[model samples]
Target chain A: MQKVGILGGGQLGRMLIQAGIDFDLDISVLDPDPNAPCKLFANRFEVGKLTDFDTVYQFGQTVDVLTIEIESVNVDALEKLHQEGKKVFPQPQVIRTIQDKRLQKQFYQTHQIPSPEFVLIDNKGQLADHADFLPAFQKLGKDGYDGRGVQKLTSPNDFEHGFDKPSLLEKLVDIDKEISVIVARNESGGMRTFPVVELVFHPAHNLVDYLLAPAQITPEQAAQAEALAQEVMLKLDMVGLLAIELFLTKEGKILVNEVAPRPHNSGHHTIKANGTSQYEQLWRAILNLPLGDTSAQSLAAMVNVLGASGHTGNAHYEGVNDTLGVKGAYLHLYGKKLTKPSRKMGHVTILDQTLQGLEEKIDLIKRSIKVVSK
Target chain B: MQKVGILGGGQLGRMLIQAGIDFDLDISVLDPDPNAPCKLFANRFEVGKLTDFDTVYQFGQTVDVLTIEIESVNVDALEKLHQEGKKVFPQPQVIRTIQDKRLQKQFYQTHQIPSPEFVLIDNKGQLADHADFLPAFQKLGKDGYDGRGVQKLTSPNDFEHGFDKPSLLEKLVDIDKEISVIVARNESGGMRTFPVVELVFHPAHNLVDYLLAPAQITPEQAAQAEALAQEVMLKLDMVGLLAIELFLTKEGKILVNEVAPRPHNSGHHTIKANGTSQYEQLWRAILNLPLGDTSAQSLAAMVNVLGASGHTGNAHYEGVNDTLGVKGAYLHLYGKKLTKPSRKMGHVTILDQTLQGLEEKIDLIKRSIKVVSK
Candidate 1:
């Protein structure tokens, strides 16, 4: 049996385990938490830190091919494994460029990829020198996700209190909508990309509230974004799935925001809306199998079920039953033992034959569902 | 957490384990073999005979709800468990009637359902008394599947040499084509049926070789079959997926042939073709959740991949790569350790926007692929 080892055991890893069944491939997952969601479905489960070289090296020994669910894995260990003749998808180089925001922006600049202008700051002292670049968007070099480690600076005083150590200050372009394109590639250079999806975030929390596929953009803009995503994949020389976050400016220009090197949150809607899910596509691409269809059968919107504020005891889903009663509403509760405010507990994807219909159903789901703690 | 215990640890159980991830429910499976296909994915796996009352009853004690992959499970133990407050879907009484051909036929007659004429015979002596019923079809009432334990008797002398006790004799059906309807129902009598699918079996093997959805039948005939299936569900009070096999006679009459009380193989195409898969629907129905949409997104055909005769060593597929190259062909391989002649190892479902195109693709898939053992 061909065994595929995954580096992290988050929800993406959990979903990948389900996709592995389609090909009957054996799966082994490594994560620090024993109760990680992917552990139960994988063929073998190992509790180990993702960034520890020894742990990753040991996990690599048991599988025919290796992949990652989270980008914050030990890249040096993955490079070693790749050199030792083990197939590592989303190659080590791709992870190296994406793990750090500073290097990621530099890579885009080096590749002539169109992205927002940014200035790299080595420390707080360097920020003083780039003070003229105020009103900048400050992002930590590494370990950032879901709007964390990112801030908008409107004055020079904001730079003085910016993040410690290495960071990047990018020009915050006036955006109309935040979008993402999930693309898959094989070792043989075969590639395919799903339609761009516009992300709508919660007004107060700034966390993604819903994902709208076939982003409300003109055909020309969609085509340009798809082509740009393909170019990014070729430049990265990446395999497996790559999710490219993009910004649509008011001037009708598309700029690269960032990229994730695994099965992404934005593509979750594909599980119910498309012919082949993003999880399934990741497995097929990594295994070098022919990719399945990527066409969506309907308009789909996904709503993340974030934990409500001031409730952090045992999880209790209020109004979940009522939300389930809505036609085409699919609720997926991540089996987490605890709930914290701003933490994603689960999500629901609603699909309909028309965009207006999907939007109406999503509005109902948004109003009727609550993820809280008892 | 509501725990569910499954009786058979095969592919059906494995698929259920995958679906259980979405609901965050715990699943345990019991099977006679230690290396059952479902062992790798289920939350807990126990080795025990499915037909052993003690084993089944003991397994049922660990879960709140109980179900089965195959109907051959011990009904007496399930009945005892149900009496003790365990929720057994497709109730034990339903399984008892469906497990044996004679009992199943009797139940149909008792309910005034339309079926072919048949007679139950305890031994060859009983058959001799009905000698005038020559050229009859004889089938062993128990342990019959995939054309096994069934034969056509040309004369009274034919039953003298090769005779089995407790068999049923019926008029040989002159079939134009075989078809099946899959229906799902909850305990509250809420039910829905998928579009009818026509089955094309291998001539000599008599195993379902291909399944074409939205069977090429008149609208009246499809309506008749669907209505009959719902009536059976209401009569049986089945609370899960029910697959009713039917024979379309040369005269265009539909006759009920048999029933499977779980996610049937005939509905596998729904995984890719329909809005909701039979696996997901079964989970929802048994859990008392509202049934999902069973409408097809496109036309589809499912072809079973059986191991070739005289080639049974280690299982290795020869034409898998070629088959994968076909557009819209979705392959599902059951993780089985061994392969023998006529062993069902996997299946491929082809989907298309049009029925005519799907039919053409089915012919291409049949001609291009061969399921051979290493």
Candidate 2:
């Protein structure tokens, strides 16, 4: 059996450990919190700071292969581990490129991948020269996480209110929808891609509500999205799974939004909808095993359980009885005890054979599900 | 969070720990082996003898709810814990009734649950008095684990090699096929049953090979099997999952064979084929949550990966690459390093909408998979 260690022990690492149990591999995880979700599941859970180079390098030395859930880990240590023949996935160079928006866009430009045009500003003073990108989004070139670092600018007024630093001003394109494609690559160079999925955003919150697998799009558009996602993986030449978020322009062109080189949110429905889940695929790829089937088992949708506003105590679910009764719905609570406003507590994957049935399931979820604290 | 303590930590306990991770429950397990399958996953893995009254009773004091993966545990301890207000599922009385074959058979006869007629023999000398059942199966009424306590007394010669003690000689029925139904019951008296599954045995090994869910039986037969299984749960008056193995006689009658009060091998397909798996249902019943749907997502079959004969050092599969290429196949390997002839190493589940497609998948598995050791 091979030993596989993970960089972070959050929900992604936790899910991977759950999936990895089926294989004849030893799984370990490193997280700062002893109470992390992956603490119990991983064969070994080491408490350490992910950002500390020594902590990550020391952990990497004990495993045959190393991969990550979060991208904010120490890349320098990963590069050193790779040099020591530890089989670091996504390659340290890949993370180094993605950690900064400026270099990520440069990599996209160099590879000629279809993406929205972006120009870099060294400081807020340089914002005037890049005024043509009004209605653009200014994302801090480094250290951005979740949805925090990016600020939408409908006008120059937005710039003064956002982070004043070296940033990439991405020209916002008129898009019909956002979609994602997850591609898996193994050490043997075997690769496969899941069908494109349409990311549906909540109307008021503007965060993703659920995703429809094999996005309801023209056959040509679906092909375009999948091909573009594959191109990104091939260009980056990274092992393990990569989730490419794309914007389907009103004109029907596919433009890359960003890429995550790990098991991702867009593929959460895979656990119920696909024969091979994204988490399992990560293990297969990094372990040099065959990539699993990425085909959808049915028309699938994923609904996230966000922490309820005005809740700030140990988490308690409201209306789970009514919600699960909807049929074909799988509630995956992330085992986090606390609840704060808008936190990603968990998600539900509802699968059906038809789009209408999927929506009915989704509606049932929205009406009956609430994540609160008591 | 609610604390759930399991009595054993074998495969069933390991799977429940895996399934329970999706729900926010603080899980713990008591197993003597430090390397128990559930050790890595349980929130607290306590090393203790499951059959020791003091150990079980003390462990039960720590958790709000108690359950078991194996039945040969200290029921007296569980009874005491129940008396003290700790929730013990499949309650001690139910276990007491099912643990003894004679008592179990009597319960069926009293409840009018169709079963093969049986006559109890107090000793080997009494076997001659019960000579009318010459072709009966002489099963020891106590301490039976696996296939050790039962034997087919086809002739007087066969009796020389069977368990010579107080036992029940059950009249053998002309069986068409063997099937199983999994019934789930909760504390609120709410109940549900999975689709009837056809259990297939390997002729050479005399052990189950795979089982097909929604067994290929007339709709009436399917309904009859499910009703009988539900009746068993109702008669036992237990709260937990019960796997009732039944014989479908040539005359089309559904006769009860035996029952297990926890998750069984027959329901393994539910992990990938049903809306909710049997493991998840156990937690839901024990935790007093709403029972999940038992509806099948597709036609399904599961193939057991028995350890190969000849070499045995550390377990390794010979041909996973070609087997998984069959697609729609989910391989779940128990984390056992040593493999010997006929030992269960793991199982592979193949699911499809059509039985024809399923057979093709099963054939692919049969030809390409071999559980071996390096």
DockQ of each: 0.65, 0.65
Q: Which ten residues in a row have the lowest lDDT in candidate 1 chain A?
A: A316-325
**Which regions of candidate 1 fall more than 4 Å away from where they truly are?**
A201-207, B201-208
Tens-place lDDT digits, model 1, residues B205-291? 977668988788999999999999998888898899999999999998999988899988899899888877898888888888878
Best by TM-score: 1
TM-score, chain A only, candidate 2, equals 0.97
Local distance difference test, each candidate: 0.86, 0.87
What is the fnat value (0 to 1) for candidate 2? Answer: 0.67
Where does model 2 exceed 4 Å of error? A203-207, B160-162, B202-207
Index of the highest-lDDT prediction: 2
Q: Write the per-residue lDDT of candidate 2 for residues A1-374, one digit (tens) a residue.
A: 68989999889998998898888668889999887878767888999999999999999999998999988899999999999878999899999998888899999999999899999888887787767778898899888889888988887666677567888899989988999999999988999999999988879998777888879898888888888888899899989899999999998789999998999999999988887899999888887778888888788999888899999888889978877777778889888878888888889989787889988889889888888888
> Which window of 10 residues has the lowest lDDT sum in candidate 1 chain B?
B365-374
Error in Å for residue B206 of model 2: 6.1
Residue A177 in candidate 1 has what lDDT? 82
